[model samples]
Each structure stands twice: as structure tokens, then as C-alpha cells.
Target: MKARIVAETLVKGITVNAIAARHGLRPTRISDWRRKAREGKLVLPADKNAVFAPVKLAVPAIAAPTPPVPVTTIDLLKGDVTIRLAGDTPAARIAEIVAAL
Candidate 1:
């Protein structure tokens, strides 16, 4: 489909505006195709020699592993509690845990 070609071109680093100009398509339509590609809903054409060639789908990159989080240990009258918090940990949950203790 014409839309798929535009999307594949866009995924290959071609600008959406350029694809629109080259294919005589509207820029908005090209943007829609890019969105579909990002969502994995667009079907790209396969090469004859490389049937499973990876298409550069417009997806977000996976974040690298962060450093180990600091663990805070509190000694209570009843018992000692150890709390481990990571860089990605939510502040609200940490507050709740501390409150419960």
C-alpha cells in the first residue's frame, strides 16, 4: 500500500515531510502512518532475499539499567525494618511504607 511505503521510508530515517513531497501525499497522512508504525500496526513490505529483515520500527528505546538503589534500614523498638528503594521507585509508596512503620 502507498501508506506502507511512506511509513517504511519514514522508519528508514527519511523525514515525513520529504516522504509526503516525494509521494505526493499529505504530511498529516504521513504523520498518521508514522504513528501506526510506532504502534506495530503497520505491515511493512518484505525483501525477497531477506524475508525477516528487521524494519526500524519507530519505538522508544529501552532505558539502560540504573545503579543499585540505596537501602535504608531503620531500627525500631519492636523490630528492625529494611527498606530498599530504587532510582525508579515512586515517592508516594515510600512515604506510605514509612508511615505504616
Candidate 2:
């Protein structure tokens, strides 16, 4: 009887709350069956008209490290003025130079 109720509740267009209310059972009981089904403990009867799709899984591959991009220099040009700077120059010094220009 419980399995029949569960099957009816699982049918298309049927809801657990509606089936529970109709059968005077708690919604939690119906939901428990659903949870069990999800965990492979409960198996619902297959419908004759049901269509299933094949699932494919790929084996996880090891990730390779990304090489760092090389930073060599910074060039600031304004009109006939050109400022050549190293990539390792301090940000505050760069800001001061920019502010002075």
C-alpha cells in the first residue's frame, strides 16, 4: 500500500502533498521515500513508456601549471617627453612621476 501510494505520488502531474492529503499520510513520509530513491536505497518501478538517456563520464585529468607572464619595463610618453621605467619600480614612485608631469 505504501509503495502504491509512493508510485502514485511519483507519477507525472501528481504531487507528494496532494497524494499525502488524499491518503491521510504525512508529506514527510512521501519525501522520505524520494530521498531514499535518490540514495539508491529505493528503486521505483520503471514505466513502459519511459525513455532513458545514456550518461557518459570522463576520467578527471591532472591540471598543468600556467607559466607566469614576464614583465620587463614600463614606458610613459607625453609630447616630446619619454620616461623609461623598470617593471619592478615602486607604484608610489610611478604615481609621483605621473603627478609631476
Candidate 3:
């Protein structure tokens, strides 16, 4: 019972390691108790003087944020020049543009 109390105190951020050691309990047990408390598994005593009280189990929920879309830019100077022959804008027209450039 004393060990549980000491562990609870440690969980509450109180420096009670010495007391826990005196009760023949490892600090890791106190750490586990604290973790259990956060998970709402450990119940603390209702009395103000009590070391621990009963707590409701709580599982934290996490949500991931949506990512943004990528933007692409086309730079004519850096782009490859392709000449295609079609009924409308034929290869001859492209040649004219390149000659003008």
C-alpha cells in the first residue's frame, strides 16, 4: 500500500523516490504506475489524504492533418523544343517560330 502511494506521489510530480526505495520498490514501478494513471487504469483514493484515487480509463485520440498539393511550373526556356507535323500547326510553322526566335 505504501509503495502504491509513493508511486502515486511520484506520478503527481512529487519527489518521493526515497520513500519508494524505503518501501522496497523500484523507481520503474513508480514510472509504470504513472503511465497507468495517464491511461486511466489506476484509480486514486477518494480521500484527500489518500495516496491514489480511482481514475477513468482514457485513450488519447490522434488525427493527421491533410497534406497540400504540389505545384509544377513550366519554363519555356528550360523546356525541350519538339517539332511535330500536323494538318494544322505543321512542322513548317514551328520552324518559322524557331527561325524568328
**Rank order by lDDT, top first?**
2, 1, 3
lDDT of 3 by residue, 1-101 (tens): 63367345744555657656766777677767767766778765555565676899888787787775543432223246644344345457656766765
lDDT for model 1 comes to: 0.67
> Each candidate: how many clashes?
0, 0, 7
- Candidate 1, 17-82: lDDT as tens digits: 787888888989877776786777876665545556578878889999997766554332326656
User: For each candidate, what is the lDDT?
Assistant: 0.67, 0.84, 0.59
**Which runs in model 2 stand beyond 4 Å of their true positions?**
52-101
**Candidate 3 segments whose C-alpha is farther than 4 A from its true place:** 2-13, 49-101
lDDT tens readout by residue for model 2, 1-101: 55567778767899999999998989999999878877877777766778999999999998998876766888888889999999888899999999899
Worst 10 residues of 2 by lDDT: 1-10
Model 2, TM vs. native: 0.45
Q: Estimate each model's TM-score.
A: 0.40, 0.45, 0.37
Worst 10 residues of 3 by lDDT: 70-79
Q: What number of backbone clashes does candidate 2 have, counting pairs of residues 3 or more apart or in separate chains?
A: 0
Pairs in clash, predicted candidate 2: none
